[model samples]
Target: MNLLDPDQKHRLFWLLQAGGWAGWALSFYLGATVWGDPPDNYGFYVPIIAAVGMALTLGLRWAYRLTWDMRFVARVLPFLLGSYFAGVLWMVARTFIFFSLFPEQKAAFGIESSAEFYSYLEGAISAAWVMFGWSALYFGIKYYILLQDAKARALTAASVANEAQLKMLRYQLNPHFLFNTLNAISTLVLDKDTNLASDMINKLSRFLRHSLETDPMTQITVDQEVAALKLYLDIEQVRFGSRLEVLFSINPEVKHALVPSLILQPLVENAIKYGISQSVKGGAIGISAHKDGDDLQLIISDNGPGLDFSQGITPKGSGVGLENCRERLKALYGRSQSLKLGPTLPHGLTVTINIPFSQEA
Candidate 1:
């Protein structure tokens, strides 16, 4: 049946090799023993020769894979051609080599070209068909093996996709979070200062608008997300005033680069909560983005309480924000991307996000 599957292919091959050798050797022994053939008839050389020929077929598919148009016909066509050639070579070479290697076997099988002088032409014609059958079986198994391998790969990809979809559904953003934040803004205005509350509301509106309007499939440009983050900081500044300040050193190339929706929102929120809020005088939050080969490197660092002391700085909430972002990244990009939170150059918290360019930023 299907032979190409990674598991089945090798198993099939070993089975074929072992079976073929056993069958061929048994048949030779039976015929020779029944006919009172010479002792040389039971030599292992014949089976070894046949096994080597079958091994050649295994590599044929790989050689064709590199050359083919990736179509079934194209890939199999070359392999078939190679299989035919290899089979013929195996048959012809093995017959001559083994016959010559042991002069006694040539006489035992009644196949000595030296003794025949083309006298057994009728028998030779029949023997040719027998060799052809062996060759055909070898190639047929390889063809089956390749098909099985393709199906296995497809199944693996589908399983991975299914898992990712489950994760995405589980972590899908909650609209209720926005509603709650809106209610917080309303309370801030009534129970707190109106001007500061107004600024916060305005910033919150921009952030909500950006999040709601972002293209779900094609990623939003990094610059757009950063611009939205700036608005968020502006509003938070109104609330924190002298307690919060932000500095950005962003690469121009990545501004238009693609990034997932609201990639920076919650991370910045976490930074503010732990970094500046914990500091007595409130320190600065630094944001930077750059290109690293095929990936975009984003660093968000804040001067706040450090983590574990030895590693550097720590954020306030033990990093629920970074974990959420990490979950989202795995859902979207799997292992193709990464998000890491650690200490910055100074005694502060730093969050690093690696976005792949091939995944479009």
Candidate 2:
């Protein structure tokens, strides 16, 4: 029932216009009945006066519409002059009909024919004030509708920008990971390990197919995301062989909880590249997810050489992935999500993420 909604503007305008004139006619009839000696045909005259006024004002509406885009100050004189002239026209029409219907009212007042011009002038002034009021109301409503339209456009533009930013951040990770996997496959091919290279290529194909099919702007359930991760891990396992180990400790209660699509891939990639691959005895990566009251908490940890902030050193290529994850989370959840990097129990790095717990419908 939003009358001001842009879709309903035309219907609302006509309804208000008819209703306003009907009220004006009713008030005129009631006033004449209470005080003045109304003629037997006064009801007929009232409607004619109202119809003439409505028709003249409709023309004024057309004129005002043409000036809608003008500056407010520039429009003032036009509105005033237009309303006054329309009012004079309406007054002339009403007077002709009134005197024609009941000529005796002129003689009842004992007014001379010479004074008719003065009476018409007085009536025109009153009609002008009425037109001025209508003009003010028309402008008020037009401005309100314009303001609402501006706000709606601003919100739509903001939403579009937000979606584009999220898509950019999400898509950037795919190419970074793709180049690494392709290089690995290349290495295996050069080493003449045809069997391993073939298997890695198959797994990489399935992973990429899934990645392409899922939209970057969508959220997937924890279980589905973990399934995608396993596909990725299959390819990585081929490259690292026995050197890479992965452990998943997912709570069944939170398996249906939702997270951004492909949210964990870059984090796992970082662990594999900077932690496990850096060690002679390649390390194990542990990923766990659980519900923490109203939040979903995910932790990815590795038992490898941890970051040494004391020496102001960080793993190469770590920032891009971590920062990408951080930005995506911020864009999706605003201030309600967090990503923190810290040391694991003994000698590794752990990335912890906290996001609002929401389940798929």
Candidate 3:
């Protein structure tokens, strides 16, 4: 639809030109043959006239383009008027050629004197309609193409803005994540637990390196996501010891399913922050992935006091981890993906995500 898109515009131009001109020629041929008793030579002359008109319109198409480029209104009106005047001249030339080729046909149309040539010019009024029709078509197509180009540009700008926002949200996780981990390491150092602090630091380095190497926009397999989550949990396990129990019941068939990289991390982080970390005896966190028809379903849940939505109280109070996850999912999948929060059995919080099942990242 875009005029700047050469292949689409070029194809449409040829189709309309061929169809319009061919219809004009066929209508003329039928009108003369079926409605009147004309000379047999018209069989040859009529097609020639149609060919000439089509060729002339091609030139007018170029003139229209030039007119469109003119900035001054004064120049535009004069150029268009000049093109219409040229169309009248073209009819004059066509009439002369027809009569000169078959002088015998002049008598048939009742042309007997020089003064009578003016009568032949009267038919030029009909040719004027054809010329005006070509002009209308040219302008109409150009207007439509301009609108399509504008729409395409607008969509491109919106896509760029969404990408920038997604990057900002993804990077936001880094500083927040680093602050908490470093604080834990500092606590260990203060307690004189050098060996545990050293282990946590090593695991933290590996987790940060993995996160940095992958682009925020890129997707990864569920298996890769689980491995990253385990590295993250290992660092936390050093802090919580046997208090933090991690369980994963991922379906083997769904392990290769594609998902946004680090998408599950924020969900798991939320579980730890609001569920496991708040409990005296700590809690167990469960992660699962399965294929449901054409969708990939992922769930992260914990065994801690869940939110009471019946009382209109949801534990998500501008939580950066949960909010980041939600925004990232929206950016990636628009309306096709989903994120849901609910209570788990007995008493716990659960986060569920659904995205289109695909093998490619």
Best by TM-score: 2
Writing each residue's lDDT as its tens digit, candidate 2 over 277-335 gives: 99988989999999988999999999888786455554333567888998999989999
**lDDT to native, each model:** 0.67, 0.88, 0.84
- Local accuracy of candidate 3 as per-residue lDDT tens digits, 151-254: 88887788789889889998898898899899999999999999999999999999999999989878889999999989899999998998899999999999
lDDT of 1: 0.67
The regions of model 3 sitting more than 4 angstroms off are 1-86, 292-294, 312-317
Could you arrange the candidates by lDDT from highest to lowest? Answer: 2, 3, 1
lDDT of 2 at 342: 80
Worst 10 residues of 1 by lDDT: 117-126
Best by lDDT: 2
Model 2 worst lDDT run, 10 consecutive residues: 309-318
Show where candidate 1 strays beyond 4 Å. 1-180, 183-186, 311-319, 358-361
lDDT of 1 by residue, 186-282 (tens): 7777886787677777777776676666654446777877887887777677657888989999887777887776678677877777778787898
Off by over 4 Å in 2: 1-12, 26-43, 104-117, 120-124, 309-318
lDDT of 3: 0.84
Looking at candidate 3, what is the lDDT of residue 355?
A: 90
TM-scores, in order shown? 0.52, 0.84, 0.83
